[model samples]
Target: MKGLFLDAVDELAAVFRHVARPGDPPMDVIERGEIRPEELPGLIAGYDFILDDHTALPTEAMRACAGLKHVIFLGTGARSYMNPEELADLGITVHTIKGYGDTAVAEHTIALMWAAARGLACMDAGMREGMWLRTEGVELTGKTIGLLGFGGIAAEVARIASGSGMRVLAWNRSPKAAPGVTFVDLDTLLAESHVLSVHLLLNDETRGFLSAERLAKLRPGAILVNTARAALVDKTAMLDALRSGHLRHAALDVFLTEPLPAGHVLTTLPNVTLSAHSAFRTPEASEKLLRMALDIACGL
Candidate 1:
């Protein structure tokens, strides 16, 4: 079977070339930024499967791509780009890679948490603009941090936060246990945490999980951090909380919209810190991600 690595941006094509084995399935790497849903049918013609990085493959458009049997998504958040169930009904199995960037993403989550706690971004931006801004910072040495979900990434985050002398509390949809991490009910997690870091995966049940009602439960002046899916929180409620000083600050690595539009309300918020959904971006993670994708293609 043949394969195509679709949407290999940010030098991923080079990484694919470096990790690909001689005996692996023959795959073509397309070094482009993004491909529209309408382009999928044509671009995937004659290819048995495609390795999608970040493309929108609407079910209607994918239905036209005859004989395309599989989609090897480069990341676990495949639902953000396509409806896997809809494609499954059309005989296209969508496969997602996980654990490839767990450590990389966890480290980034810690970075954002610290940055928000200390107002590092605001100070840096102010200094660059010829102003010396010094804001009061939150000391996390003995603070409580809540993890919304328990998973591979959250596990790594727990280790780092625990080692830094912060108390770790976690609430998962199901039961979980970790050394030095307390498993608590959602209500307890929300009310007691000084820093709330979201790690829940997005789905029908988890989308908007942190609604206005839930946001109201959080301790006032608590810092919010999300390196997981953006849809997990109510963006409107989050903005309102920030504006009213209900939340001390929010450090976000993911968003409701990618490449958040210019003049976006988030850019104007003094209490917001934004990263380009790049928590999982690192040389080590990139190499491991491509190697894992290639392994999936070989099995296909």
Candidate 2:
């Protein structure tokens, strides 16, 4: 079977080569800077499988690629790129990798939280510009952290927060328990937590899960952190709350629109810290991601 690695960004390609085995189907890497939906059909013309990192394979494009049978998405949030159900209807099996970068992402979440709480990024930027800005930050000790979803990433966050002397409370779609963590209802988690971290997967039910009404339930001046898909939170609502000072700050690694268009409102806010959706990035996580993708591709 012929396979194409569409949008194989650098560094990751090196890791992919290391894990790819001999005797496997020939794989081609297209080193383009970006792939848009309109370019999908021509780019994937006759490949039996495509390994996509962040490119979109819209249903219309998938229908045009007559030979494409499998999509080995490099991460778990394949829905953000292509709808699995829609592709499945076209006889294309969408495979996603999970548990490959849980610890890496969790560590990043903690890093963002600390950065937001301490104004680390702003301070660093100011210092680089010859200005020394020291902003007072809230202490995390004895504070309550709310986990929006209790999955692998959230579990890891719970572990780290607990070790740091912060009380952890989580609200999953279903019940879950972990040492030194309490499982609470959504309202309780919102009303009580001083810091709220979102880790839910994006789906119909979870899309816009943190709406304006729900966000208002959070304690005034609460900190918000999301390493999950940005669509989970209503962007307008979040901006309003931040502008009103209802939310103390936000540490965001993902945005509804990636590469977040220049001059986006979120960029202008002082209380918001932005990361380029790189929370899951690390040497260790990169290796695991490549190995897992290759395993899935080879299995097919």
The alpha-carbon deviation from the true structure for residue 13 of candidate 2, after best TM-score superposition, in angstroms, is 0.9
User: Candidate 1 — what's its lDDT?
Assistant: 0.94
lDDT of 2 by residue, 1-300 (tens): 899999878577878787788967789998775888788888898899988888878898778888899999999999998889999999999999999999999999999999999998888888999998998998999999999999999999999999999999999998788888899999999999999999999999999999999999999999999999999999899999999999999999998888899999988898999999999999899899888887777778
Each prediction's whole-model lDDT (CA): 0.94, 0.91
**After superposition, candidate 2 runs with Cα above 4 Å error:** none
Which residue pairs collide, candidate 2? Answer: none
Best by lDDT: 1
Error of 1 at 45 (Å): 0.3
Query: Mind giving the per-residue lDDT tens digits that candidate 1 earns over 68-132?
Result: 99999999999999999999999999999999999999999999999999999999999999999
TM-score of predicted structure 1:
0.99
Q: Estimate each model's TM-score.
A: 0.99, 0.97
